[model samples]
Target: MTLLIENASLIMSVQDNGRFGFMRFGLPESGPMDWRAFNHANRLVDNPPDNACLEIGFTDASLRVEKDALLAVCGAGYQISLKGRKMPMWMSFWAKKGDLLDFEKTPGGNWAYLAASGGICSQVWMGSRSVYAIGGLGRLLQRGDRILIGKSIHRSRWDAGWFIPQENRPAYDIDISAGVVPGPQYEWFTDEAQTAFWQQKFNVTSRSDRMGYRLRGENLTHRTGADLLSQGMVMGEIQVPPDGQPIVMMPDHPTTGGYTSIGTVCRADLSLIAQAQPGISEISFIEINLNDARDKLTKTIEDIDKIEKPQEDVWTQL
Candidate 1:
């Protein structure tokens, strides 16, 4: 089966769980910005949780199904329509050949995920199908791009009408609190800088992207200075440059950096930052110990595992 891109305003690409274990080789894991939504979209269509899906960015796009297919969408700030009829997100739907799927940008979040029943057919690079444009693995989807669809292994299940509960959906409202653990160079910052980092609310600048989010807030001065030998970096590491502004490393961030880091946003809260709409989202940091971070992440995974079983009366009211 094939899916054709009819139109796109910005960039959309295929992203799976992520490219892992290859970061040591200088490859950053480029996956869905909102992982929970991505996984939920896949599960709604009865696809594996980590199956490849369309990662739609902060703009408009549309797709046309060349063959009958089951699909789902999940995330904030976007609306999906089939053949000009509006469809609810976080729920499974069926599309026949020639059906056009339209995605309209809304005002809450920045990214969304579209998953087909069998996942997108794409070449894997470094053990993942995620598109890392900077690394030249795959380019963004464009008009007339024909994306192959994998063969579905499961039978028809859309009649079950699965949906993500409203309470479980991620909120993209203002003044979001993101959990973090101290980075390796946490102590390098002055006490006042550290205090301000936690106390102040930082606005996500328009400069943010898959590489990192440059925040605008009170400058965080470092006692040990700004320049450091380039060291290994990871997703969520909050690195402060000489300008004293913090840059939260993301999935496509470089393998190494020369700035001092104050803390690393925990895995559980990375989605919160990822969904933060640039130029409008305000974020605050909450420090958590390593153990707590791990425990929270474990619980999140457990909750995701339970999504396959539909709960009565839990459908999100559109």
Candidate 2:
């Protein structure tokens, strides 16, 4: 079984959870931008949480089902159609052999995910199929790529009506107010800069990519001369350069950053920022306490855990 790429998006690739244990050697954990959506898509199709899926970024894609299979699409900014008929997002649907599937961008988000009943088969490096082109892990998917299906799910108790509840899904609003915890260098910025950071809005500049999102807004001045030695970095770190424009480190960010970090977007709200597009999204961040942020993250994980957790594998039982 396979899915043939007819027209791939600008950035489409097979990504599992991420590559771990190599970050110390300058590799970034390049997974799906919306981890929650990615997991839900897998869950709906009876795949394990870390199963590899197709990540579609900021555009449209077209594929043909080479075999009869169940599929699910989740995340924001796109709508799916099977054989030219509209399909629901966050729900599992069946695709017959030779059925054409199209993912068209609508609005209000950036990344989308597609998962089949069986997980995708890809060459894994360092225990992950996630693509990190800069580090040579894998490359961007092309139009002619053939994505082979993994193990078959024997038909037993499979349900096609599985869907992620609305409350659990991301809002994907045009304007987002994300919550961030103070970083180690929070005090590096002036008091005015700190206040403005919470009050002023920033437009995501076109100078954005999988690496980082450069924001255009008020010039945040530094109190300590903005001289911070290069430090280890992670996803969602808000680094302000000498120009005062802040750049939000993404999944493919460098191993370390030299600029001063104002704060870090919390896990619960990081996906909102990730789904935001450059021109259409305006973002503001408010301070979140470490304890409260931890609770929010715990809640997000619990919500994903409750979504379509498979009961039992029919093949395994037989």
Candidate 3:
């Protein structure tokens, strides 16, 4: 089966759990900006949790189903419709041949996820189907593009719908407090700078992208004026340049950098930063220890498992 893109006002591309184990070769893991929503969308359609889905950003888009299929949409700030009838998000529904799926403008968040039964069929690059446009991995989807749909094991079970509990969804309208752990060069930053980082609120700038988010706030000063050798960079590393403005690296960030990093966002909060809309979102950091960060991640995983296999009535769960 195939899905045809009718219109896309902004960039939409394929993303999965991201390209892994190849960052040493200069490739950053490119995956869904909102992992929770992405995972929920897939689960609604009975796809593997890591199956590739459409990561829609900013604008309107429409798709036409060429065959009977099951699909789901999850994320904030967008409304969906099927053939002019309203369709609820964070839930799975069936569409027949020639059915149209429409996504309206997002008013709160910048990204959303759309998942189909089975998964999107695309060429894998370095063990991932994610579109790292800058790395020449995959291109932004365009109108008239034919997206092949893989054979879904749950296709026969599409008679009913599935939904994520309202309490489990992440909210983007409010200020986000991301958890952070000290970076390798945390001590290099001046005491005042360190204090300001945790005390002040930072606004995400328009220059933000998959590479990093440039925050506008008080400058962070380094105690030592000496320049250190460039070191390996990773996603969520909060690097402060000579100007003092911090740039929080993202999934498509470079493999290494020379800027001093005062801290790194905890792995669990990476998705929070990803969903932050540039120029609109405000962020703050809460310092945490490595052990606490690991524990939080474990708890998040456990919560997700419960969402996927709730003990409630299976037939009336949604």
Candidate 4:
């Protein structure tokens, strides 16, 4: 089976979970910006959580399913329709051959995903199907690209509906609060800067991308003489440069960095941060202990874990 891209989106790529153990070699784990949505899309179609998926960003696009296949669209800011009729998102839906699915962007989030029942087939690179374009690994999706579909886990279980509950979806609120813990260079920032960061609202600049989110807000002042060698960078690390503006690392952040990191956003909120609309979202940071950060991440993992196992087996109905 195959899926054909009729109208290409602004930024579309084939992505799995991500590559691992390669950052030390100067390669970042390039994957879907919103991990939660990506995972949910796969689970809706009974694909393994890390199966390859279509990552669509910020564009009005459409595609035609070459064959009858089970599919799902999960993300924000996109109105999905089939043959001029509206379709519900975050739920498994069957597409007949020659059916055209259109995605229209609205004003809430930046990214979305389309997952086939078995998952989109792609060659493995560094143990991942994710495209790391900059590294010359793979390239962005193009119009007319016909991607092959793999074997799905549930071939005939469409009798029951599957969807992500309202509570489980990403809250694309205009203003969001993200919790983080202090980083190694936290003390390097002035006391006033620390207080202001927690108190003031930062606007996400349009300059941000998959590599990092550039926040424009309080000017975080550091010790004038402070300087350090470039050190290993991690996802969620907050780095500040000569200007007080902070850049929160994202899934595609470089392996190393020179800017001092003031804090690390907890893994639990990374998806929230990713869903934030650049130039529109007002993000506030709150500090928490490491233990609390870990607990929150665990809870999020548990929540996603429950999605893979459907509450009631649709197979039972058949």
Candidate 5:
């Protein structure tokens, strides 16, 4: 049998490829906020893309294993340990019955991913296990909640030698060298204000969440300040309401919004924006042309594919 989670400390949920095509009906794409990092974590465990994972939030969550299993923990800084011995993040490790796997909140990043050999087997909603926190539909793991495990991973190994170690961790800087193309509302801004947007720096406000990041910077302005009819929104679309401050949308952003969007953050750099932890410091936006943005997006995807978490594939030898 697969290992069970006897104690799920703080916030935890099963997230997979994310629910899509429903935004037409006003449902947000409520998948892993940092999907690139999450997918990489799964690959490290040899699990294919779309395998569900425990989306550990800002709070450090804890759990007790009920059986032996292989697991990989990835994404932002977090103190992970098994039965008091230190465990590495972004790499696979073993856990046995009664072994306590604990995760502490990261000082820099906003989320962490915990992936098992297969994945978390929770009741699916709309064909996904992603917890839409506002909908109250998917699994919202709580204390004393015994999570059901997937099938037992009979045979699997880890390539700890080849994979990169957690010590020399990759850096996630908020350099906005790649800004989004100004959208349908770009004409509304004066030339001077548009210049300031790409020139000035903005600090991530304390009110950030999975929904959107409220930025505090030079007052981003528009000529009309008039209310507009609600329109479609995607992650990274910077929506400016009446206050002139921009709210960068995230995975769970609303399907439609009435606010005017001056520009959007490119998909390639969305994670950088998502990983901006509260009180971390100032983040500046730099504008990049459309062609450059597309080229970068293609390269990022290929780079992630090359960095597979070798633990998952080891099972093939069994």
Candidate 6:
């Protein structure tokens, strides 16, 4: 199977689960902006949970099928059509050879994922297919590009038993109520600032993307008035620049930073930030213990797993 990039504003190279165990080498995890949707798209196509999928950003994207294929889309609801017929978002469907797939501007979230049966064929680097935009490694897609398709084992049909229920689908929201934990520089902030951080709401600025999200909120000042050396940073780390606004780092974040980080966003709520559309309202934070954070993430994985496996009856029908 193959996919021809007929027209698209921007499409990134293969972005799978992510590159892991290399943060020590000063590398950041460059994966799906909305991992929940990436995994969901793969599940819909009967591919492995971590299979590679197309991570599309806010803009027009179009493609043509070179062979029969099963496909699905998830995340920000964008304009999608197959052969002049409107393609439903968050549902698995089939496309025949010569079918044209088109995607317009994103109406909801910041990114979208397009997963085919098996997965998109691309060269893997560092144990992942995720494009590292800054690393000069993986990259955005281009027009007139013919992409290879992996061999699909489940090419038969879809059964209702394997369908994802409406309630199970992920939704887009603005009030990002994410779990926050005190950072190394948390002591530098006064109790008042800390309280304000959680109580006050901040608006997401237009200067946001896969790299980091900048917020326009109350000026958060440090208590100690001290400067610290540049240190390692992680995804979801909220750093306060000299201007006093907190910036939440995302998937394609840098390895190090010089700003003071007052807190870090919990893994469970990272997706909430990832799905935030520009002009969305500010989000509040609640502190949680490390063990609680782990449990919450574990439970989320279990819920996603439920969506991956095909129902017994559904498989039999296929």
Report the CA-based lDDT of candidate 5 relative to the real structure: 0.73
Number of backbone collisions per candidate: 0, 0, 0, 1, 4, 2
TM-score of each: 0.93, 0.94, 0.92, 0.93, 0.88, 0.90
Pairs that collide, model 3? none
Q: Which residues of candidate 5, in runs, are more than 4 Å off?
A: 1-11, 152-170, 174-178, 308-318
Higher-ranked by lDDT: 1 or 5: 1
What's the C-alpha lDDT at position 213 in model 1?
A: 86
| Residue lDDT tens for model 1, 97-181 | 8999999999788888999988998999878999999889988888999888899864543343677766666655766899999
Q: Model 5 compared with the native: what TM-score?
A: 0.88
Please give the TM-score that candidate 6 achieves against the real structure: 0.90
Better candidate number, 2 or 6, judged by lDDT: 2
Give the Cα RMSD of candidate 5: 4.0
The Cα local distance difference test for each model comes to 0.85, 0.86, 0.82, 0.84, 0.73, 0.78
After TM-score superposition, what is the CA distance of residue 219 in candidate 2 from its true location, in Å? 1.0
Q: Runs in model 3 with CA error above 4 Å?
A: 156-158, 308-318
Error of 6 at 16 (Å): 0.8
Q: Put down candidate 6 lDDT per residue, 140-218, tens digits, no spaces.
A: 7788877888998765444222445566665466666788887879888878888888889877788987789998888
1-318, model 4: which lDDT tens digit per residue? 898999989888899999999888999988888888898888888787889999998788889989888888998889998777788788777777899999999888888899998788888887899998888878888889998999755555353367777777766687988998987898898899989989999888888888898999979999762357988988888898888899999888999988888999988888888878878888989998999999987777666645432556542331
| lDDT of each residue in 2-81, candidate 2, tens digit only | 99999999889898998888778889988888888898899888898999999998889999999888788999989888
Alpha-carbon error at 251 in model 4, in Å?
Answer: 1.2
- Against the true structure, candidate 2 has what lDDT? 0.86
Residue 231, candidate 4: C-alpha displacement in angstroms: 0.7
